[model samples]
Target chain A: MAGSELTNIKSPRVKAARRLTKRAFRDRDRSFLAEGPQAVREALALDGVVVELFATAEAETRHADLVAAATAAGVPLLRASGEVMAELAQTVTPQGLLAVCRFVHVPLETAVTPGSTLVAVLAHVRDPGNAGTVLRTADAAGADAVVFTDASVDPYNGKCVRASAGSLFHLPVTTGAGAGRVAQHLKDSGLRVLAADGAGELTLDDVDLSGPTAWIFGNEAWGLPEDILALADEVVRVPIHGRAESLNLATAAAVCLYASARSQRTAPAGVRRPAPAG
Target chain B: MAGSELTNIKSPRVKAARRLTKRAFRDRDRSFLAEGPQAVREALALDGVVVELFATAEAETRHADLVAAATAAGVPLLRASGEVMAELAQTVTPQGLLAVCRFVHVPLETAVTPGSTLVAVLAHVRDPGNAGTVLRTADAAGADAVVFTDASVDPYNGKCVRASAGSLFHLPVTTGAGAGRVAQHLKDSGLRVLAADGAGELTLDDVDLSGPTAWIFGNEAWGLPEDILALADEVVRVPIHGRAESLNLATAAAVCLYASARSQRTAPAGVRRPAPAG
Candidate 1:
């Protein structure tokens, strides 16, 4: 635990980051792992966040710019052995750089908004990569928020964060309890809930997605649960013409979210007018 | 390879099915890996194609129905240690079973009609999961085919196969030398090429997707190369209404493909009849 303060975290930070290897440790600490120079760079790019950056001496030597940026930003930079980096990293080959940052908690109250808003809701989606991709898509589609229902994989899971391609830092993503309550809040706020079902009464195209809408995508093993499906004001299917069993959950969510975006994007300018041009 | 000539694989033949592991051997022999009781059951469900099956003694004792089904289907079976099973299987946790079946290449040319065929032209999509998911989406959307441009991942990669969720077997997927030629053939077949771009002139809703169109989705990194973009008769985009950077490739493809499906699905039945009622 030498040089362990926030200003300098070498072995201690590496040891802490390594604990992320177990799901229990990650959950208990409310922290997860992120690796590779790109992931580290993105993590550092976020404002006002405390970060523990671990890099090999070789990496520090070779990528002086990265080290300088980390130092300048006041992020705790740690020198770690390649073996330690490998132990802490998920990839078969560690990229000689990793970051441990606090998980940003987006309050449900903050996520709720009036007027036309788009949000993505995940129900029982356990795969970290799928959850992360959904959040990334939500951000790309300009959704107002992302809500993860109970039993969904932790959005801050290392795999999910990495899968998000750094979009996790850019978006307001909230997990844990109150997801259902938040969904209801959005309902009360006038956003229609549309659950995506492989089999549903309405095709996604048939539904007018231009209005304030929340799209629900669920586990690959099962579509949205029956209760969630019942709660939705509308259940829509992304019309499938081919012979595959079903679209991947993440891909399906992206399609539905983008479909909403398409509808909003193509709305007549007169209809989509900003409030008196500010 | 005992009972190699047996038309119906029974209890006696089960002993002969275990030896097909080495990649060099699998490649030289034109056979590949398959796993899971469900997957094996699925393989047996198909008419008369099971060459051999392998299962741990535990699986044989526990899932008697699976062994019975394999026996009924005349597929040979082999018993192996759990360690051997782990080495032979692609997934980290062995499903206590494996299979070595002759590779069935779905001809790129098969079942394609020149008039009004819709296909996905995948170019340089290096991620195996993305490639497989795209192919699977193409299958689910009932597209005529999926073409892997030269730089795309090998469709046969285990990850690709796992991601495709068995659609790779049914979908008319082709790669390598003939991919560009196939694109040319698709164009000559009167299929208009429409490349998908993050930044493009026509949004998905703006474009009339109801036609014999080949939707081109590109690599995760650079997107559709300029040369490939130039080949397209038109360039189409999925409108981004959110603050996110870009939609994932498979998601983009799904949106385009589903848009096409939606347009075609809503068209008068007489306009495009179902292919001979299956």
Candidate 2:
């Protein structure tokens, strides 16, 4: 392996890693590719899902720590040429490194149990970028978990994995669950379920967000379907005090989650916690 | 006009409208294209900037209100076939409608003035999508204006225009000015200048934002230069409560701006307003 480097894009291992770029293939293999240094480092830090890493000689030199970490964790690090690495990474300017990892999402029960403090649920979110951004936002807010409902995009989609930065590996995620089930779980776990919708009667400012809460975000275009909105205990909207019509999904989610984090952190007592219905 | 549908993508007028898709051509022609129904409607609503409209027959029927709006505003509406419309719009699924409009950025002095409450400045922000999303976030936060510095991406770039939703037309925007001049303008206008950075010594939570303020946001990859950061009265970071390394540009901007909105709205006795420096 000293003088030899993988140069053929169609080489068996290279082809195998490239296949993970497609959603159907990813699902079949239960694996996906994490591109760039940040994502690869985070996946390696997991020390579990990462099966192997492909790096150009330049990337190997640039990311020696990642190579050492992978080595210490018993993960194989393959050396590839620029062309081979480009074939494995989706970005226009390939970062010359990538990781093949098992799906990062866990089962719904394993993601968040009873009495969870903060949560974000993607209900019918279709855009890969939006889904990933929301996940990153949730993680930054210290959310216990993020739920990608049946109608949401695959978390392992190449664009999403990149958009999430390293946050994809930072927190627990539950995917392919139904929105109704997610809402019920949050409610049963003693958290108030809030559907974030543009047409919601209550603005985000109107709520006491210090409570243990799970927020359900809807489709980028049409927003949450009526049934899903009904499952939430309350429908809340991020206030738009200007002439703009509405906030995009990720910004809206951030405003909502950050409000919850600030409020929950500064609450004078436990008084803002939600009470069960009679 | 009912039978005069433009079916050829390269026909004189069609090609002219299509040319706006390229930034150089747009600048030379002093025009840009706003795609999709939401953007087209908003452009028509401006009663200015809009030079003409291109539509497929199906779109004219589907967007009857938009057609009526354009007709009533005396803006020229040209019918095109779906294929021609696709050529004129960059989206994979074109909405079959778009607007040819002049550049939208206003002169700097006219965008904001003394006593302006909230403002956002883009310094060295190169990504068109990020720039547009920040513009939209600022709009939703009811910011007085958005300034795109000389180093920032052009606001008329197709992706930026689309990402801005309709916010491009909702409020005043200043573009192509130097960041230093913009910061000085904000200071002279009696507003606090805050730079949002990941490594700022002051977290957003540490400052009182209930006052007239202007925020300078840096590049997606590198952030602000030392000279630019030094120009700010206070450098601020949105607190990351969890394991995420950092928030994306748009989400961070939203968190900061919304915090200011909430603080300024709820401030009593105007006590949080900043005092002039010695």
Candidate 3:
């Protein structure tokens, strides 16, 4: 509401939005792009998370509710030309809405406090799409947080932000930590750290997931190395019951996290179903 | 081994391979392209599936074992130039090998026999990646087969083939059929037909997945239409216990199919854990 119509694509505000596309600029500004109406709406819902809102004149009329909500939330809404919006947005057909939001991730120490029932740890995950899907899956499963090891893809990457489908705004995500340190931290917080590997000794069904647990996933191409696998309390695999070689990273994470979610929701207190007979 | 070196990118074999990139060409020829060593290797393992194998001269030396296997299998292995190979491949850096395989999908009737315990039905799924991932997930879960309804993307699309990770060769996939017809056929096979919807009366946990079942998944954007959801015996939602709105199509399919796989594997015949009290 305070900002004028930003028609020039080279304007500082538009340039800033474009800069957020790179990891260096995002880290420096501690802000990232949340594009499309759904993502922007979700970001606006989070108090103080949305720093600035940009909408093309058409988008303002099309998403009147979102514009009104952003205005009511005291977010500075900047009107931009279609060309300016297109320059700032990633999609082939720009959705006409973009939000610059402060990094919503909390410190790992604060997120993994006691009573953290479920968490997802991604180690050396290089694909932004997989990383984002895992984050979305983790959020859907009610995980307390997600931690990306130092070698993982930037969780704020444009493709990742798009793949997350707005779930990135729903939960705390931590990045740039070592797998060993993250594993130790989770274990220190009284959570069982389980590494998901293709060749694990125990099947996912064999694990007791009702207690506080940290599910560790690895890279898409090459999975967790031996050293990282050793950091977990146990290594488990989602059983490949058929001829297919393996599940994709995100699907594997979904199965693992949902299994834990189902178990924790059903099992009474610390009691869980015994591992099924092989 | 019998074919001479093909240095020209305009050779008939290379032209045919290039044409397979289009759906119309693939359908008319009833052949699809399988790129990379893993996919080519898997294609060779299936007797008579690999019609023609092409490799760069450098690839021939690198993949001696594959060449030997193909030679022993009596498949015509054509040697091509790097330029020809690059033109044939979709990747920025071609893997140096490609295979033309006849469509391996079988008749839906044969796939949905009475003995079939688990199957995946995808209706109106437009994303080639999501469709392929679902196929891979179904295969990994040991489902009997996967069926893509009429509106679905061609399962043989290059992106779909890549996302399937060779699982496309592992199981029978049926396509170009109506959703209603597929649903009716599955029901007639004495399998419980369950439609997966984000908004459904029953959660996936409440369903009896231990029995023979056909799980139906909808499109990536707009989910299953009302008519399709109405055709199923029951509509079940994967429980979203967190703030995330919904699971991606592929992840939702993995969760559903694996739930069925785990249930069918763990539960005794006609006996399963009672639905957890919610």
The TM-score, computed over Cα atoms with residue i paired to residue i, of candidate 3 is: 0.95
Query: What's the lDDT for residue A74 in model 3?
Result: 85
The residue-by-residue lDDT of candidate 1 on B1-278, one tens digit each, is 22322233333433233233443454566665667775566556666546777778888888788888887777777776676666557788878877666665555565345644678877888898888888888888888777876677766566676777777666566666345676676766767788899878988777766667788888867888787787788888877665556778888888788888777767765565323221
Per-prediction DockQ comes to 0.60, 0.79, 0.79
What is the RMSD, in Å, between candidate 3 and the native fold over all Cα?
4.4
For model 2, the stretches where C-alpha displacement exceeds 4 angstroms are A1-4, A272-278, B272-278
- Model 3: per-residue Cα lDDT over A1-278, one tens digit each: 54678999888878988999999999999999999998998888888989889999889999999999999988889999888988999899989999999998878898786668899998988899899999999999999998988988888898898888898888888888888789888877878899999889999999888888899999866878999988989999999998988888999999999999999998885484332232
Candidate 2: tens digits of C-alpha lDDT, residues A1-278: 32379899988999999988888899999999999899988898775889988888998889888888888888888999988987888889998788899888889988877757899999899999999999999999989999999989999999988889888899999999888788887887788999999999999879888889999998867988999989989999988999888889999999999999998888888666654553
lDDT of each: 0.73, 0.88, 0.88
RMSD of 1: 5.4
* Of 1 and 3, the candidate ranking higher by lDDT: 3
* Span of ten consecutive residues with least summed lDDT in model 2 chain A: A269-278
Steric clash pairs (candidate 2): none
Cα error, residue A171 of model 1, in Å, equals 1.6
CAPRI rating of model 3: medium
Specify the poorest-scoring 10-residue window by lDDT in model 3 chain B: B269-278
**How far does residue B21 in candidate 2 sit from its true spot (Å)?**
2.8
